[model samples]
Target: MRSTLMDIAREAGVSTATVDRVLNNREGVRERTRQAVLETARKLGYVTPPDEEGGNANAPVRLDFVLPAGTNTFIANLLDQLVTQAGAQDGMDVHVHSIEGFNPDSLARQLDALTGTTQGVGVLALDHPTVREAMRKLAASGVPIVTLVSDILHVPRLGYVGIDNRAAGRLAGYLLGRLLGKGAKRKIALFAGSLSYRGHEEREMGFRHVIAEEFQDLEVVELREIRDDRQRAFEETAALLKRHPDLSGIYNIGAGNAGIGQALQEAGFAQSVIFVGHELTERTKRFLLDGTMDAVIDQNPRVEAREALAMLKNTVLGRRFDYHPPRLQVIFRENIPEF
Candidate 1:
């Protein structure tokens, strides 16, 4: 006896109408829910109709995700979530690539190489001429592009899937400024992964703007080109502390939280200097508890990865959908949720 859509829906724990939509390749079904229905249909030995392109309906759509090469906990979390979520989806074939040293030429070459290979691309792009040219060319070649985590200007991409970085930076600045408590002329150190990344640059701009407008007593001293390297962050932080022992606060526009925390602890300024950074990883959580970090601005990588994939696939399939930007969460020790 042949199985029915009702049977598949029952097994998939979704409504029969949703199973019908999935089997018919109709719009309005979510990517994961659609995949779940499809998996159930396959398990029940139900044959689905051919897709619009007249290919195997079950064949996956190939997409690539390009991220920076680093051990940054947030990036690592994004990579992991990309893999895990794509694995759960039936129609997404996601390939993740890391750009070495955040090199523009290398990233451009990578984009050029992927021209004919992938149906879509989601890149954490740098705001460089070569990289922008590559992205424009790729978009011109009929492949859809989506910017993930970071965005580039004047690019013909499908959409951006990440938090509002400028707002997040302002929030960080506000937390640090208020925590320092009506400072009577205090210094705050700002670190960035690199200004080349549009996200980081926007964060720096917002942080500086808030400090200048609201907290006139606080002076922001920045050390350039940290590159999100732990050792470099540690060294620069140690030297900065030695030069200005009265550094009242520290705000990292990017990663290297652990290194900054280590430097503060070693200098015996962990409790004195209010530290705020990005990402709510295990280490950052520990820092929040131990008073090494005062606040962390976090975005859910799982939501980002899933959104990126959905945007890519929907564009390739010419499906119209609404996009919601991911929300940013400000976490402290008091409100840190269990993973």
Candidate 2:
């Protein structure tokens, strides 16, 4: 015999009327109660109409995005684009959560919490063991996962939506090398948000590879962590300048461009030091214009947001999606586009 509302209600310890509300997507249902009712229904083979699963007949699918909270202009821009684009699409229901700091434990907890609430997930991954384990669990439980900006390896992610980070890093290295010239020996500083991020680690590797192979004269004297905070970046840069007064170049593997630029200006090395970094923001634009920054290797966040959303939605609906990596664009002062 087929299951009824009364059966689900009794099994879930809720009234039939409560079950009705949950099944029909009515309000006043507590999240825990709703989860209980839904789980009991599924367990008892109480099939609901396709449209009624998430909400009303025309309800949209829910997708959650996990991103960094306090720092990084590029991430903030990506979050804005995701919200705007998701709002425009009637079929997409987007929720965004920003993690305060680079804590893998906190990120893992957030991912674990989304198991029952969202149909799909897109995350700016922190490549740590705990976070990767959480992703594995989510994938095993049938929620489709897609990585944005950075990726976690050896996991079942639908796709990664971003530029080729290795190539971008190599390009930055080459640019810095050419700007500094091959004739003279010089010192360079490298900054990273965190090596726990796969993209950052890969960029550092690529940059080092290029510097070693092509620009042997340029020595990477310091490798520092900025945590993507402007203040932290400023302190690190200031200390670097004091230690190595002849710091000829800098390649930031991630964000925090504003802090580094400010530090350079205060130390009177803005024009002398060749600064190259990632992302093109309002602050970076000003730096490039004033000759404080040489070049910026950028990826289109709009395209990344679109591709990630499409990948999640397609996976949820059992459809196929094409993964097109965003092209890397080198932004110079002459070709800086107006926002």
Q: Which model scores highest in lDDT?
A: 2
What total of clashing residue pairs does each candidate reach?
Answer: 0, 0
lDDT of prediction 2: 0.87
lDDT per residue for candidate 2 within 1-339, as digits (tens), equals 545556778899999668756654568999999889888877876554355556543568799999988779999999999999998887889999999659999999999999878888999988989999999888665566888988777886666788778888899999999989977788999999999898999899999999999999999999998999999999999999999998899999999999999999999999999999999999999999999999999898899998888878765553445667789999999999877
Show model 1 residue runs off by greater than 4 Å: 1-55
Each model's RMSD to truth, in Å?
A: 9.9, 9.9
Which residue ranges in model 2 land beyond 4 Å of their true spot? 1-57
Candidate 1: clashing pairs of residues: none
TM-score of 2: 0.84
